[model samples]
Target: MDRRTLLTSSLAGMAAAAASAPETRAQAGGSGPPPFAETMAEMTWQEADAAAKSGASVLWAFGVIEQHGPHLPLGTDVYIPSAVLRRARQILAERGHQAVILPAFYWGINQVSGAFPGSVEVQPATMIALMADVLSSVKKQGFARVFCTSGHGDALHNKTIFDGVTAGRAASGIDAAVLFNAPLVKRLGLDTASPAVLGFEVAESPARFIDVHAGDPETSAMLHIHPELVRKDLLPTLKSTDYGPADLAEWRKGQEAARAKTPLGYFGDPASADASRGAARLEGQAKAMAEVILARVGGK
Candidate 1:
């Protein structure tokens, strides 16, 4: 059998066995949420197999450790998307879909901020190889479907991730979908105008597309998710900075050659961030992504 066919057949058998056998319960009892282990780190081989057999979709959280101004933690990008994934898992399970949230991927291409402290940069080629290997292993283990959710938004970072998905397919016939969570929020028309979840639009609370990093959206998110990590004193004094390049290529060259332009290493109006608005942003993103996953790969 071809790789996909073989994997699908194996999954079918496992599902059948799982149906007849007593359910392998997570640590939690009722329908509150899947065990912490099921959604986060420390998942064992048995847990993974059981989840896959139970028709659960594995969700991979992808993010990077990089500079996010002097005020925010270097892991702002990682933390934001991870919060979304955690909430997304709950949303999915509530909707009758079993979803496993994996650990976040820390190493990513930091072309713009590599010169700064606390930024860990991985080359495009290396990232592609690592992603391919990861997908290959997931398929080999028994999962027929996978989804990658990301918070980082550099041009090279996105290209590397999608290329890794393509490479995984070419190298091992692994089928998966990746969603850059921030862009997905915008693309789904959730970024602007009024949203159903909240009484008002969160557009004002987040940074504009051009001023993505350490901006209102991220700062607000951090304020809501991990208030302790945020430097409340700096919010009053921080100002907005724009990345004024016409295109991604120009962005890479300009930022690298002139690091002094963004001495604080942040953009957008963080002063306007609010905890309630940040919570709304998280729900909007999670709900939109959940719909996409259900429509695209939930049956598979």
Candidate 2:
């Protein structure tokens, strides 16, 4: 069988093993959220080699140091995805799973907010090559599984990263995959071993009338995950920069048009954000991410 096919066929057994694992979430219970210390940057070579030899999985949360409607931090994309992965890490620990969280990759393609002052972007080829190289190196280090995810929503950002992932897997023959944003997962026809599609579902998400960028969904998330980064005074003033097909086309045109379209670099109603809702969505996304990892690593 092909590698993908072999991986698919073994999913059922993996889930069963996870379900019957000795450590239960209840037994692993604690107050507040978890503090993930299994960071690749912090680990010594010997420690990393041991985890790889033990068949541990890993995470790479790609982010963008870009604008978020002038009200959020430049690292909003970085913070949110990294936070989700941290929560996912906690869940995996509860299930007797172990995985290292790689250092945040912040230099990603930024089309939507490119025209804004704080938005940082790079060539598509750079991102693609980076993805391939990273995966290849992960395999060389002996890791058999890895999940690449991000909170950024630019269409090209999604396309380029997936392209990189495919190229990386083909060249290195590694087991690297992505827990892509919900829209791209469906768009690319990718599916996970888990029953639920692990991507972030845009349509059914916490976003209201329109919540793509610094709108309710993202704003509320920051409020819960990193409230200090949010500009409380600005939340009351931000308005909806609603998105549709036309808006998407404009965004894709380039940074100039994107800047013209949303001068403040926002695209949703941040005014409607709620901290409580933010907390719930963070946990929800974390649970889904954890499920994806569990199914991938539990079987072995």
Candidate 3:
């Protein structure tokens, strides 16, 4: 079977397993209003305190304010993760657990898009330090469990998150895990069984490595969540650039040449993107995330 078909089967199996999964402890707060009631940014300090006292877990959504393509906005990364987290939060609420989503982290390591307009870049070290601080602070606030997620799958971006989580766990002495797009991809059974399997292998798939950036998956997601921001006029002509799979030699080729390889900052056939498919994918992943959240907070 092809990789995509394999992934669909794996995710279906995971979902079926989740259906019979045991109930997890409510570490955030007791049953409250639904997850749709409010976001962390919208919660009052008093309400937050009460939830903490009740053992509410916090969900930190990661998104970068980087260029998507000529057709999509700079906030595509942010919008997609926030929407998926929101869906997971709703599911957690149904299970009598309280979860709150923090505002998106707009500043991320946007090395690839640094040359592109609208990219708010941060040093890798700085992003890691910042994530550590934020997560450590969350633990100090008495939330025993905290979940982190990112839709963007750049190698450096994933490195920052993993590093930050390691640092945060050490500093706070709490349980933490980053639901990186790669592990999600692997868990869903995409790609071969190489120990070095990278997220972009599947994420970029059958296109330029840059396909992970503004490809069909991302475009469809943006269409599902924020069609208003998508420039329909530009979609018709957008196509993957000439950049192919890279080698160690390409790593030495430097950033300028890298951008030159895919000048438009996009790399896949977005023409295939569909909102319904995007919605289904998002829902499945969100369910997987909710299952992980429940297991982490208090499952055997």
**Among all candidates shown, the one with the greatest lDDT:** 2
How far off is residue 5 in model 1, in Å?
66
Residues 1-300, candidate 1: write the lDDT tens digits: 999999999999998997888432232233322224345456777887898777777787777889888778787777787888888888887888888876777799888877788899888899889988988887787777677777887767766766776787677776676665444445434322221111112233332445566778788888888776777788889876655545333445535642566677775567777888788989988877787676655432
Number of the candidate with higher TM-score, 2 or 3: 2
Candidate 3, residue 91: how far the Cα is off, in Å:
1.2
Off by over 4 Å in 3: 1-37, 182-210, 240-254
Candidate 1 vs candidate 2: the lDDT winner is 2
Q: What are the per-model numbers of colliding residue pairs?
A: 1, 1, 6
Q: List the residue pairs that clash in candidate 1.
A: 206-217
Q: Best TM-score goes to which candidate?
A: 2
State every prediction's TM-score relative to the real structure. Answer: 0.75, 0.79, 0.75
Tell me how far the alpha carbon of residue 221 in candidate 3 is from the true structure, in angstroms, after superposition. 0.4
lDDT of each: 0.70, 0.77, 0.70
Give the C-alpha miss distance for residue 132 in model 2, angstroms. 1.8
Clashing pairs in 3: 27-55, 28-55, 28-56, 28-57, 29-55, 29-56
Q: What lDDT tens digits, residue by residue, belong to model 3 across residues 33-145?
A: 33233567788888878887898878777878887777887778877888888898889989888887777777887766677778887888898788778888877777776
Per-residue lDDT, model 3, residue 134, is 82
RMSD of 2: 17.3
